[model samples]
Target: FIRLMAKPEKLGDLREPRAYLTTIANGLVSDHWRRQSVEQTYLDALTLYPTEHQPSEEQRALPIELLLQLNTLLQQMKPLIRSTFLLSQLDGLTYRQIADQLHVSERTVKSYMAQAMLHCLRLKNQTDN
Candidate 1:
């Protein structure tokens, strides 16, 4: 990790090496907790989905490659754009409704949706090839 952070000479010159490492470790730990929380929330929400409308076993079992590609694509989007996409697709919100909920203009909501769609389409194209 030190080698990854900087050259050895620069790494050795840090006045508070313990503090530096502590900060990095804390950040990594916090990110892990955050991801765990998000995964738990997603799993919990899955129980609320209507059984009649739920995806079939095959549909639910997306290839790991495609899942990773989609995750990468979503992570690259701005928070607002990602939220807009989720609210529209997952929550079944209209553009106007999302705009009102997000305190943004309808045009902004549309723009965010377009940005998210383009990102997903690009990812899909890459995965398809």
Candidate 2:
């Protein structure tokens, strides 16, 4: 409602208000669930550390927030590019290995990585400003 009020132009002709409101409400609920899941996953990972090595509550918030932002960023990427980037970064797969898995050329994997890195860099720059 705050958003609609702030940008009343988005409200359009005010026709079918119920549908518009329902769409917005559904999106909010989905976002809430995604955030909760991310937070829980972060907390679960924290449990793997010894007590003294665990981050303070204040410190933990930053990584959890970063994870949420990273999740959103990845979701915006093209599926193939996302898979290639994740394979290399998360699964420790080499470009050749990713190429074979995806049945693409190593050059293609390199291109995808470049695109992913550029996307991340652009987002970082936007946040920095």
List clash counts for every candidate, in order: 0, 0
Q: Which stretches of candidate 2 lie over 4 Å from their true place?
A: 1-10, 13-15
lDDT of 1 by residue, 11-119 (tens): 6678897888899999889767765665555456666898887656566545433444455676789999999999999999999999999999999999999999999
Q: What is the lDDT of residue 111 in candidate 2?
A: 99
Write out the backbone clash pairs for model 2: none
TM-score of 2: 0.82
Q: Pick the candidate with the highest lDDT.
A: 2
Model 1 residue 16 lDDT? 90
RMSD of each: 5.7, 2.2
Residue-by-residue lDDT tens digits, candidate 2, 10-129: 778578888888998998998899999999998998899999999999999899999999988998899999999999999999999999999999999999999999999999999999
lDDT of each: 0.79, 0.94
